[model samples]
Target chain A: MAGYQDLVLRVNLTTGKVATESLNKEWARDFLGGKGLGIKYLYEEVGPGVEALSPENKLIFMTGPFTGTIVPCSGKLGIITKSPLNGYILDCSIGGSAAVEIKRAGYDAVIVEGKSDYPVYLLIEDGQVELKEAGDYWGLCCHDTEEKLKKVYGDDYSVLSIGPAGENLVAYACITSDLYRQAGRGGVGAVMGSKMLKAVVVKGTGAVRAADAKKLMDVTYNAYKNDLLTDTNLWAYTDGTPMIVELSQTTGILPTRNFQQGTFDQFANIKSEAVAAAREAKKGCVSCGLGCGNFTRVGEAVVEGPEYETLSIAGSNCGINDLGAIVKFNANCDAFGLDTISAGGTIAFAMEMTEKGIYDFGIRFGDADKYVELPELIAKREGLGAELALGAKKLAEKYGGIEFAMQVKGLEFPGYDPRGAWGMGLAYATAPRGACHMSAWPVADEAYGEGNPFTIEGKAEMVKDLQHYNAAKFSLILCDFWALSFDIMAEMLSALLGEEVTAQSLEQAGERIFNLARLFNTREGLSAKDDVLPARIHRHPLATGSTEGKTLPEEEFIKMLLEYYSIRGWDNNGVPSGEKLQELGLR
Target chain B: MIIIELRGPLARYGCEHGEKGRIEAKADNGVTVRQILNQVPIPLQHVGLIVVNGKKGSLQTMLSEGDSVVIFPVVAGG
Candidate 1:
């Protein structure tokens, strides 16, 4: 417990009560922190059958042991809740100083439950906590709200605020912090809105104490110099995520035209070089040395990024090649606190439905003029926005075209077209939060690395190992950009916590956390049937590019899924076995 | 002569002639892709993907005259 804050803050908005309790040390030992710890809390506290956007739901904010320390890229705050979009467990990591601020304020986690009668925001300054009326800031955009809060609380305070997308209860609404950083998936902001809470502001003056400062510093400095600053990790600083646009393009996984094609002819117009051409500045999250954030400006639009996901999902997938339009769309989404992936995916699905004569939303692919205006509409839930706000899953259910809806578990797919990367399809289908690229990116090894992109052979084990690795890595709250191995992670944790941590133990913890999440999903009525890709992926082959004439055959996908389940010690139904749970100490 | 293309940050290892990201290498009929890579100053560990004539290739892949090769660094992001 040397690295932990050893405290949990509980707030009841309806009754206007605030209290602090000791963190469960046993759970901390098993879950580590961040995503793992937060999910464990959610699984235990928020039982099954609770509606996501109701007062019965709970929102938990958590930070890892590495947070507030000298650990590099350790400033991620995990927001765990039931997703209003899909009624599933959702945990989103947001990069900013909020995690550090929360840890410095002497707590490992903050849990908010029940609903407030009026609009309010939780303000925490060291030992002091208050729920202040936020009626004045209710209707403001995320950027303006943060600015207003900073002006009132001084610049030292970090604010996490939701825009109109959350206030209006958009299913894919996101929570924005530090203006551009967001917990951007699965209606986390809607959960906040459902609680009638607008923002959480914090200022902490205390410092985190490392168990063995000398050893921790030495190990961290060594990794920072030898591993992090090397060519393997330097791409984040030189090009950031925009560099991946070309990688995904070359691998035939660019996800063009609502994933109907694997390649985009206009990819050059929105690639990393294009972003670099319009780049005005570079930014990074707290304690970050890589500084992967690219602050771009085109025409009058400015935003921290149209990161690779935004570029591929909103730009090429929508058939809009105009970088300026994508930049404006990115700014709009950031201002309105929308998940750009879901927004773009929903619009792209509509475009395809209209083109195919299934339904007409008066939008077409490559309509950049109309595309840029959608975030405001969707946030306000007006006219076309009302339909778009329902997200891709609901839209497909309402109209026809469920085959091309391009979502898994009601969450929209990210930039990768899984047909090109077979292992990536498995990663998406089995991801706990649904279609989440962050869960496990097998594309790196298959499409982007030396491994064959179009094969299922050896893919099951690869995906399983990668998922476990990412689970542990995110629990430590390190940036995914680091690409450091498990050995490095174990060394750092061992030094920081004064415990004999090993790569094997960390992996076991990851497996435990992953299984616990699966159990939570099973208890909520999800089974192997829920873990599936859309018909477009299984039935339709991409028409052109390196992946031309390729489809992840349904039979092949089933084989891969069974193999993955077996590897994870799960039953054929994708439920963790009693023995497996006991092995991970879950039972 | 075989044409070699570098992408993204690997463009720094491009040859002196042709374009900024392109290189022309004289390769024997039996030369492996590893041999051609060894002839350049590019870091082998940093190479994530190797494409030969638009198809995925490996270090053991044999090279021939007029072959086109593209090399890129490991790509990872969320």
Candidate 2:
């Protein structure tokens, strides 16, 4: 309550009108903030059967308590809406200045409803908000759009814009920001485009004061300044996340060639060193001294990425080891405003389909030369890319190869191959936002030997705990990488809120958020059967490495899920029980 | 004897490149992977992915003759 501005601007684009509303203090107390708050809003507004891409679907961009604070890695902004990709409650958070800028703009969140008569962009400067005509910016790619907006609004305004992909309503289109980071899951961008909205530009110079600012600042500064000494943060700052390339591949969980294999033969080419060598310099999110975003020098121009997901999907999964080609493809996706992981996964699925002779789509793994132009084609809805833009599961279903779609709950898989890590398999299947890794990342437990990746003995408890805590962190809009130690995090939160927020309370908040997401999904018709993994993960054994001859045992997974559900206060069917919901004050 | 090249964080003191190191002593006296690491001046705690002859190998795995090893530090990413 102390850090919050206690106000939100609701814009009804159809009527070109804007109205301000007082913050629901009770809801804030119940849901906390960020993804949790956004879901609460969606649950109240959207009904069970509303079409995701329809104008009826409301898009909420919400941040949290620590967003504008001096917390480390607090640049995440959550995009909450009914996803066209999966028809589920989508809470995709991206790292950028948008969350910070919006929070600083004297508001806790921005909720846009109804359809605009024409393409438009929202400009929020402090308390003043304007809906600007985006007729000229409609057809522009994300990079150009951001450049134009920045030029117009100077360097101060943080822009979250969609490109040709979103404009065309590509199912996996991304909402790009800072020309790099994106809310890149589900079809949130498609929902944005469907409403005839293009971008949200914000520039706020206002300051946020926490309940105990001095204590908060002191605690945060000590941790932030000492974060380099920590294992995860230090490693992250040194090599960026792409350094996991060798580790994952060596661990045999790299999700190679549409996840047919765990390890890649050409792993060296997609290594962090290669990515670093290809880059101009490190880049990342707002207020982040550690710039993890890569600016790869591919021939004539320096472009972004071959980040971990992009590297796995575009490189090993696609069979393309050429870092330059991967960089170019990643940059191409960025410009076109498409999710690179989905694009890469979709293309990889297509290539696999092509290999099976199911369709002569002319796709193949490692065919970097051919796929460099695929992003533009997908954004423009051209060629086979039209189908590719529909995302992996749909493309696979259309091509009659749903078995190897490499998707979970209609969302394409991230980088980790489940065979190599069983915990990741559970995480993928049980994630609230489809196949997202962030929902409950068991990477350390699964891939790295941090807490034992292979042991399913106590993994259910770990996953449940992580899911809850992470959900809570998402409400705080903090980076999961920095949530290395929950005890430290609890102390920080307590210091900021001047509340006795123990680890248990944080876990409880996360549980509440998780249940709320489930509640929304349940109301939207997601049943017990929806919680499932692809057949490939169940049937196939890892071809090479430490986990060779290993697969996510179906019975083990079922038992794990049941145990997870039990811990989550859910029924045998994985639905949150009435008692549990009541306990969380959701009922 | 297998030679292990250490890179990234392991090459802390000397250079920015990987250290061209050697593992002269083999498993003649039944030396385990952990013991061989102890023989080396540098510690193995930070090393994450261990590649022995282009395949994934753990610390428990015994060293074989003529094996080419690559030791990487525990870094980030998935």
Q: Locate the minimum summed-lDDT window of 10 residues in model 2 chain B.
A: B13-22
lDDT tens digits, residue span A259-311, model 2: 88888988888887787676677776886655666667888545656678888
lDDT per model vs. reference: 0.90, 0.81
lDDT of 1 at A193: 93
Summarize candidate 1's per-residue lDDT along A1-587 as a digit string, tens digits: 68898899999999999999999999988999989999999999999999998899999999998999898989899899988877788999999899999999988899999999999999999889999999999989999999999999999999999999999999989999998898998889999998989999998888877889999999999999988886677788878888888788877999899999998999999998899999989899999989999999998999999899999999999999999999999999999989999999999999999999999999999999999999999999998999999999899999989999999999999999989999999999999999999889999988888788888999999988888888898898889999888899999999999988999999998888888888889999999999999999999989887899999999999999999999888999999999999999999
The per-residue C-alpha lDDT of model 1 at residue A413 equals 97
lDDT of 1 by residue, B1-78 (tens): 888888766777775554777878777667887887787788888887788886677788888888988777776656
What is model 2's DockQ versus the real complex? 0.31
Candidate RMSDs in Å, in order, are 1.8, 2.6
Top lDDT hit: 1
What is the TM-score of chain A, computed separately for every candidate?
A: 0.99, 0.97
Screening candidate 2 with a backbone cut-off below 3 angstroms (N, C-alpha, C), the clashing residue pairs are A257-A317, A283-A293, A318-A366, A319-A366, A320-A366, A445-A453
Provide the global lDDT of candidate 2 against the true structure. 0.81
